[model samples]
Structure formats: C-alpha cells, structure tokens
Target: MNANLQRVIVLSLLILLMAATRSHVFSHFTPVPDASWAVFFIGGFYLRNWSRWAFPLLMVLAVAIDYAVITNQGMSFWSHYCVSPGYWFLVPAHLAMWVGGFWLRRNYSGASVASLARLAFSFVAATALCHLLAQGGFYWLSNSVAEPTFAGWAKNYGDWFAPYLQGTAMFVTLAALAQVVGEQISRHAHPFARRMKH
Candidate 1:
C-alpha cells in the first residue's frame, strides 16, 4: 500500500476508535479522552508528508461524528452547534490545532530537545485555544442576542470558565497520553528507525 494511504486508513480507524470511546465507553460527566491526538501528532511526527490533508480530514471527521451523535440524541444541538456566533471563531481554533501539529513536524524530527519544546508549546497553546473556543461557543449559544455589554460578556465568559477549565484540564491529560503513545507508534512505523536497530 502507498504510505500516504496507509496513514489515512490508520488515521480514519483511530478517529473512529476515539469517537466510540468518547461516546460509549466514557461516562457523560467525564470529558472524552482524546486518544485521537495520538493519531494526529503521529501524523505530524511520522507521516509529515501527509499531515496537510490528513490532519484536517481527521479533525473534520471527529467533529462530524460528534455532531451526528448529538443530533441523534434529539437535543437542540443543531442551533447549539451551528447557529452559535462563536462557531465562526471555533473553526479557526480547531484549524489552528492541526496547523500547530503540522508546524511541529516542520521543526521536529521527534529527537531534538529544542524541537520537543516547540511541540510541547504547540500542544499547550492548542489546548488553551480549544478551551477558550468551547467556552465561547457555549456562551454564544446561551446568550445569542444579548447586548455585548462588558458586564454581560464578563459574566458569560466567567460563568463558562469553571467547566471550561475542568474539561480542558482533562483533555490536556489525554493529549499528553496521546503524544507519548503517538511517538512510540511513529517509531515503530518508520522503516529507517526499524533498520537502525539491526
């Protein structure tokens, strides 16, 4: 099989796995564990050649799956997801995550200290952005037409911060686990890395 195709298939499977694990295996109160970040960062670390397309594809698939499941539950997720003004900003927040992973690939070969620092920094920034975007989305959905007063925005944003922080912290822990697992998987996938041992 072509290497890029393999990466895509692997990524697709991992995304599906993450979705299943998120929706079914995990409890509702628990934030979804992000094992897919392993696939994502590995795409950057091992399949750097495929990162451009693969990362976006995986992210979109994850989002679509989540939306589908939420809609199936007959909640107001349609407006909660689509009509919210924060979605305008949320898309870029998500895109930035993939971009950060791709940027990590450009700078790191998975072996250098400074490069590792860059990757770590990217992860931190992306995690923080995800938290803020999620909170913003919730705020917009809850207060769609309210006047954008300082106090109003403040209260909205502040009200969101607690849950947002809790979820983001959980996600950060998952991201760390995924990153470590991804690096290991990348090492195993590389023919050169395998050959070097012999």
Candidate 2:
C-alpha cells in the first residue's frame, strides 16, 4: 500500500505490456509501435532521485528483449554485425529517449495531471529524433548488405518511416494514459503515499 511500491508495480506492468506488445501484438497483427521507451520515461519520472542507475537499468532490459527476439528470429549474435550501422544510430536514438525522461523529471509532479501531458510531449519530441536518426542509420548500414542505389536507399527509408511515426504516436498516447493509471494507483495507497511535492 505504499505509494512508492505502487508506482513500481504499475511501472513493471507497463514494461511487461510494452515488451509483450512489441513481440506479439506489433510484430504480428499490426505495428503496435515500440512503446518500450514510454516505460523508460515512466521509470525516469517515477523516482525523485538518481537516474544514473534507473535509466541504464531500464535500457539494459530493453536491449535484452531486443536480443532475445532477434535471436529467436534465427539471427546469430555475431550476425548483429550485419546491422551494425543501423544499431549504431539506434543506440543514441534510444539513449535520447531516456535522456528525454530525465529532462521531463525536472517538471514532474504526482499531484498534477498536466504533468503527464508535459511528459508525453517530451517523449514525442525524443521519439521523432530517434526515428530520423534511425532511418538514416538503417539506410546507410543496409546498403552494404544489399548495395542499394542512393534512390533505392532513400525509398527504403521512406517506406518504413510511417511505422516509426505510428509507433511514436502510440507511445506518446499510451504514456499519457499510463500517467493517469499511475496516479490512480497512488491514490489508493496508504497514508505514507501522499503525492510528492514538486
């Protein structure tokens, strides 16, 4: 019934949901968009203290999930080399998302709803940056594997841009909802769970 405990539980569920959706819902039926960054954003805001540990920890888990899924797809670990160019940009892109979370923490308040909206906006901006960088990375990297012409590479990047945009939009929307869900859980906790002041 502790507020802190409640926040942890809600965040864990969000991370799990994002993971499952990433592998199942998005990989299959429709592009669910990678909402995992939203989980990291929540984790960043959930704690009032050090993100040096929390942000990196969350990122590690996400990478593990990516590795697990990619391995299951029949790619060898070393085969990651094949996509090194794309992964290079992806690393910074993801780090940007976590960094965005850290930035939003400056204005976070458990007692206010608009705080959630602010968080969502920060995430959207970060996601957009991620998409742009990732697209360029993939285009540049994938060329070595297939040796596409410049036009071909540009077309390839353009083709996949929609999915990234959709995923970013979904992530932002879900993150806003997750904030309310976190707040509601906090509300039901014991007396020690008073909303932290800004």
Candidate 3:
C-alpha cells in the first residue's frame, strides 16, 4: 500500500474515533476517555500539511455529531449543552495540539531516551495548552456561566485537568507505540525486500 494512502486511512480512523465520542453513537460514555486530544496531535504528526485542512474538517465533524446527538435526543440544536460561543475556542486549542505534533515530527530523532523525553514534554505541553484554552474559553466566554469569574474558572480548570490530561496521554501513548512498531516493521522489511530484489 502507498504510504500516503495508509496515513490517510489511519488519520481518518483517528478522526472518526474522536468524532464518535461526541456523537449519539457513543454519547452515553464519559468524555474522560475521548480520543480527540490525541487525534489532532497525531494527525499533525503524521499528516503534516494535510492536517491544516484535516483539523478543521474534524472540528466540523465534531459539531455535526453534536448536532445529530442533540436533535436525535429531542433537544434544541441552538441550546444544546456547551454549544455556545466558547465552543469555537476549540479550533485554536486543537490547532495548538496539531502544531505541537508538527514541531515534534520535524525535530523527531530516533527513539533514544533524549528523543522520547522531548516527545513526552511536547505531548504534555500540547495537552495542557489545549485544556487551558478549552476550559478557560468556556469559563470566560460561554453563556452557560451566568457570572463567570477568574476564581471560578481556575477552580473549574483544576477540576477537569486530570481526566482530560489522562485521556490525551492514553491515546498518545497508543499512537506512539503504533508509530514505533510501524517504523520497526518498515525498517526490517526494507533490508529483506532488497535482498529478494537482488
């Protein structure tokens, strides 16, 4: 299979997994295990420039899933939970994750301890930034909060940070493992294929 096609398939699966979390299909489950945080980062890591377009496409899917879930469940689309102005902030937040992945991909070294350390730092920073943008955006800008305040926002951020971070890290770890395995397989296959060709 073509590498690009393989990448597209993998990224599409990631996006679909993330979007499913927001859809009626999986709405009953808690958001703590959502794959969205890793989706953007992994998309950027693999898709590179393709992610610039893919990120927004996934965002649209998320909104569409929410809309479907809302209407299916007999709720007003306009007034669905967290479907407020602050929700738009997710664009930049996810983009931040994407950008972090792009940067990591660019600086990616082979799997040395130092390289793994860099990947870890990048993952944490990106997830934290995404959480802050999303959490802070909702607290400050959403109509859901009648009287938003810094103190209140700070508390909310503290409360939500752990689960969100955990979900992101979980997905990222899985992705990293897949990436390593794929590279190793390709690395081993190259030498074997060459011998056969000769």
Candidate 4:
C-alpha cells in the first residue's frame, strides 16, 4: 500500500482503539487501562501536520465515547464523568502531549540510540505534563468533588501518579520499540527486495 494510505489506516486504527478504551470494552479491568494519552502522542509523532484537525476530532470522539459509556452504564450523562466545566481543559492537556510527539517527530533521527533517548524523554515529559494538567485541573476545578485543598490534591495526585505513569510508559515504550523494529525490518528488506528483483 501507498505510504499515505498506510498512515491513514494506522492513524484511524489508533484513534478508534484509544477512543474505545474509555467505553465498556475493558471496564472490568482494574483501573481500566486506556490508550487515550498514547493516541495523542502517536498522532503527533506519526501524523505531524496532518494531525492539525485530527487532534480536535479525536478529542470529540473521546468525549462522545465517554458519554456513551456513562449513559449506557446508567449514570447521568455529564455527572458520571466526574467532570465539571473544568473537564474542557482536556483540550490543552492533550495538546501538550501531541506537541511533545510533534517535537520528537521533527527531531527524531531514526533508530539511533540518541533517537531512542529523545523519544523516552519526550514521552515521559509529555505524560507528566498531561497528567499534571489533567489531574490537577480536575482536583481544583471539578465540582463533583467537595472543595479539594492543595494538600488533598497533592495526595490525590501522588496516589494516581504511578498508575498513569505506568500506563503511559507502557504504551509509548511499546510503540517506540515497534517503530524501531519496523525501521530495521524495512532497512534490511530493501536489499532483499533488490535481490529478489534481480
């Protein structure tokens, strides 16, 4: 397949998988692992400028899926989300993540060790920023919770930090590794392709 078509298909699948992760798909799993954060990073990394509209569009899809889950799970449409007006802040929260990957996309130098380091740093930094913005925003701004104090919020942030970090790390690392492997395969395949042609 053509590169553009391949990108489209890959991006589409990533978005769908991430979006569905929030729904009833794996609700039974503890903490319910989701790829929401990873999707943003992957989009920025892979889609680059092509992600201009896709980011916002994916955000909407995520919200819609959230609503679907809440309604189906028999909770108030908006209230069940544990969100308040502040939930809208997810836009900028995820934007930071997307920009991180976009930055990496510009700077990444293939499968070199430096490239891996860059991806690792960018992934961790993006996930941290995204988490702080999201969790911190919710703590201070969400009406669903009773007036959370700084200490309380800090404690909450600490409590949730490990899991979020683990999840983001897991997905981003796997993705980066996969990309490296793919690059290696392609690099090696070219010679084989030429030989086959001969």
Summing lDDT over every window of 10 consecutive residues in candidate 4, give the lowest-scoring window.
Answer: 23-32
TM-score of each model, in listed order = 0.60, 0.67, 0.90, 0.90
Which prediction has more favorable TM-score, 1 or 3?
A: 3
Name the lDDT of candidate 1: 0.58
| lDDT of each residue in 75-112, candidate 1, tens digit only | 66556534466654545555555566667767765555
Candidate 2's C-alpha runs over 4 A off are 1-3, 24-31, 47-50, 80-82, 109-120, 143-159, 181-198
Residue 11's C-alpha lDDT in candidate 1? 67
How high is the CA lDDT of each candidate model? Answer: 0.58, 0.65, 0.80, 0.81
Query: lDDT tens digits, residues 99-148, model 3?
Result: 88888999996666786888899888988899899888888887879998
Q: Going through the candidates in order, what is the number of backbone clashes in each?
A: 0, 0, 0, 0
Worst 10 residues of 3 by lDDT: 22-31
List candidate 1 segments past 4 Å from native.
Answer: 21-28, 31-48, 80-83, 141-198
RMSD of each: 5.3, 5.3, 2.2, 2.2
TM-score of 4: 0.90
C-alpha lDDT of residue 57 in model 4: 84
Candidate 2 versus the native: TM-score?
0.67
How would you encode candidate 4's per-residue C-alpha lDDT over 1-198 as one tens digit per residue?
Answer: 587887788688887778667674326355657888888888889888688688888888878887777778778876754567777778888888899899999998788889878988898888888888888788888876687888998898888888877876787888888898889999999999999999
Off by over 4 Å in 4: 24-32
